[model samples]
Target: MPQSVDRALDVLDAVAASDGPVPAKALARRLGCGLSTVYELLGTLTARGHLVRTPAGYVLGYRVPSLHLAFQRQMRMSGEVQELLHRTRRAAGVDTYFSTYRDGGIAVLAAATASHPATGGFTVGQDTTGHATAHGKVLLAALPRAARLRYLAASGMRAITPHTITSPERLDVQLRRVRHEGVAVEVEECAPGVACVAVPVPAAGAPTAVSAALPLEEFHRRGHQVAEALRQVAAEAATFQGTADISGSTGG
Candidate 1:
């Protein structure tokens, strides 16, 4: 790729990762590029409406939303699949997620939340912690051993929460259990008080996982019920004609 385009994307990523608007100097330091180069890229991106110059610093601009919306449209689930997700959410009484192994990472394709506010907000993008999330575990369990190891090596097992499995040996044991039992469960691994259960979607195309997330106490009390609900919905979703395949090659 061209150096200019690469640097522009890096700037965008840096801004998006930041908590609020960030100045050019911070961006330069983060990207390890010169101040002048950062300014040039920022000017170009600002003119293209990909970044906006704010009083504080720079933030993503209006063009970003359009791109996000376009991506959502392209990955939108069919009515049948959407209905199945909602059904799982209703039955389990928790926020539901549908995900797949895509482009060497876990991508949350769609989600169905409760009518009222749920605990954690779902970010529709690549998820890095395959060792921590139930859905991530499900997707990782589907990969061949070598490919799985490569993914793990690339995406380190960071401890998101205290309960997260940071050891490769421990994660391997759990993944084996997921493959044998055909379900993955995590207790407060991804977040402080959240627990999730996931099951593989036995669809023909992309390797997919459907999961339900709820409070830790509720999960312990009704874990079996939620896991069953997710499995049922995943099975139903597999039969749908246009279940989205948001996956790429599972190569090492």
Candidate 2:
């Protein structure tokens, strides 16, 4: 890829990852590039309507929503599957996510959350912290042993929290358990105060998983209920013909 395009993408990623609008100086610092180069990229992106400048700084522009809608359409997430996710959120009383492993990465295809959401970190796109997320664990557990090892080698097990299992050996043990039980659970691994439970979405023609996240204390209190709800949703999603194409052309 061209250096200019690469820098532009890095700028977009940095802004998306930020909690709020990011100043141009901060973007330059984050990208380890000169102020002039960053400003040039920002100006082009803003003119293209990919980024919008605010009094505070820059945020994603109007074009992003259309891109997101196009992405959702390309994913082929049917109404039935989306409804199932929403139903799981209501039944499980937690934020729900639908995800799949493709091209050696995990992507969250859909999510349903209540007015007061529980999980805070999940976003659409490639999720890099597979080692610390239940949805990622379920997808990782489905890979062939060699492929799984290769993916782990490429995406190091960075510890997101103290409870995260950073050691590959330890993670392998958990993956084996996930494969055997067809479920994955993580407590305060992905984020502080958050616990997640996930189950494989059978017959989805990809390494797909449906997960629910809630407060750690609430998870402990109603973990079994949440897991059961996720299983039910996964089973229903498996029956949707549209789900067969959810992975699209992306290889598992």
Candidate 3:
């Protein structure tokens, strides 16, 4: 029963992650399950109003929106936190982000680009590459030891850029340094000319991190200032809850 439940949830996640309606066969391949199993689960989910079948394939049902709305409301971060991100953007003169580590993935909840906007485009709903992102490193480092190991094993270090960490052993060392230093820094790791610095928020619910991205030149010159600004925000914000235990998976 537990295994069935996991597969059902996996099906839902796959559908959600997809750009459009997904076929049963595709889902089976994605989940590594037989067609019969996927068809049965899809039927059950569609019947239960958790999925909606379309001409092309299946998408989330109406019920999913309400659930998403509810989750958003539950995670409605404080105005102060939002303001802090904005302030950080202005202070650092770069694009700023508020992210949470959930389900073994980094979910960008809020982003602010002030007068000095960054060249790269990133925003909410984007599941960032953990192996190449400072925010990802902070959150990944905060995971429980066992879960972190499981996540690392499952998440192959895919190289987004030539500078991206591709070795698990090297990444493990980097994560330890991030934890010890209480900060994460990435220089041209995710993108050629983009650099990022992140610091953990230590929120009540989930492990949250705040980050600022800038051009490589600016990041090199004022990275410490950005980190300080993020630390100030983390210091002043009231405690909040939403982050749950680490999910034993790695992000895409």
Q: Which pairs clash (backbone N, Cα, C closer than 3 Å) in model 3?
A: 205-241, 205-242, 205-243, 206-243
Q: lDDT per residue, candidate 2, 1-252, as tens digits?
A: 498999999999898777789999999988899999999999999999989999999999999888887877877767687788887777657888889887777889888887433374787678888889999999889888777777788888888899999998899899999999989999999899989999999888778999988888998898988888888888889888877777632333
**Per-model lDDT:** 0.83, 0.85, 0.77
Steric overlap count per candidate? 0, 0, 4
- RMSD vs true structure, all candidates: 4.4, 3.0, 7.2
How far in Å is the alpha carbon of 171 misplaced in model 3? 0.6
Q: Candidate 1 has which clashing residue pairs, if any?
A: none
Tens digit per residue, CA lDDT, model 3, 74-158: 5666555667677766666778887776676567776787533344345565464777889888888888777666666666678
Worst 10 residues of 1 by lDDT: 115-124
lDDT of 1 by residue, 215-250 (tens): 988988988988888888888888776664543678
Q: Which candidate number has the best TM-score? A: 2
- TM-score rank, highest first? 2, 1, 3
